[model samples]
Target: MEERVPVPPPHPAQDVTEHVGYRLKRAAAALRGAMDRALREHDLTVPQYSCLELLDEQPGLSNAALARGTFVTRQSANVVLRGLEDAGLIVRAAHAEHGRALPVHLTPAGRQRLHAARGAVYAIETRMIEAVPAERLPALLADLDTMAAALDA
Candidate 1:
C-alpha cells in the first residue's frame, strides 16, 4: 500500500488578505487613518482635505463633481462645502450659470492650507510607494485603477 500525502491549507493572505476586496478596503482604511492623523494638526478632516485637493487640481467643480471626486454623497459634500465656506477657505458662486450646480473654487487661504497639507500627504504616499518595487509603481497604479474601473462597470 502506498502512503498518501495531506494537502496543506492555503496561505491566509492569498485566501483572505490578498483578496481584491479585502486588500482594497484594508489599503483604504490605512490611508484614511494616516491622512486623518496628518490633517488633524491643520484642523482638516479627510473629506475636507480631499475637497481642497480636488479644487486645487480642478477649480470650479460643482457640488456633485466634488462629491464624486471625494467619494462622498452630494449631501455630505454640501456640508463640507458649508464648513469650508465658513472657514473662508473656498468660495462658491451664488448662482449656477447652468443650473443649481454652484462652481467651487479655493480661496488663497485654501491654497496655503493645501500647500501645507500636501507635504504631509505626500510623505505618506512616498512611504506606501516605496514599499513596492520602484519600477513597478506605474504598473501598480494602473492595476489599481483597472480594479476600480472594473467595479465601476
Candidate 2:
C-alpha cells in the first residue's frame, strides 16, 4: 500500500493586504493615528474635533445632521456633543421648527479650540500628502473622488 502523506492547507493565491480595501483600511488607521497625535495638544479626540469642525462650518446644525455629516449614529453624535458641552466647547439650542430636534452650536471657547487645532491638523495633513509628488496629487484626489462616488452609488 502507498504511504499517505498529509498536505498543509494552501495559502491564499493573493495577498489579502494588497487589496484596495485592506490598503485603504491600513492607510486610514495610520492617518487616524497621526490625527490623534496632532489633536492631543488640544485635548480633543477625533470625534470631538469632527464635531467642532462641523458645528463651526454650519452653525446651528441639528444633531441628526451632525450625525450624518460625521458618519456616526445619532446616539454616538449625542455622546460626543455631551462631552463637548461638558468641556464648555459647545451648546445645544432648541430647534425653531422641530420640537424634537436640537441644534448644536459651538461656543466661543469651542471656536478658539477649533482654531488652535486647525494648524496642527493642517500640518499633519501636509506631512501625509508630502509622501506623494505634488504633480500626482490631482490624480490621487481624482481617484479618491471616484472611489467616493462609487461608494455613494
- TM-score of each candidate structure, all chains considered together: 0.88, 0.85
lDDT of 1 at 88: 94
Count of steric clashes across candidates, in order: 0, 0
> What is candidate 2's lDDT per residue for 44-105, written digit by digit as tens?
98889998998888998888898898889999998989999999999997555566778788
lDDT of 1 at 17: 68
lDDT of 1 by residue, 5-123 (tens): 96665444546667667778999899999999999988899899999999999999999999999999999999999999999999999999897899999999999999999999999
How close to the true structure is residue 105 of candidate 2, measured as C-alpha lDDT? 86
The per-model lDDT (C-alpha) reads 0.92, 0.89
Alpha-carbon runs more than 4 Å astray in model 1: 1-15
Clashing pairs in 2: none
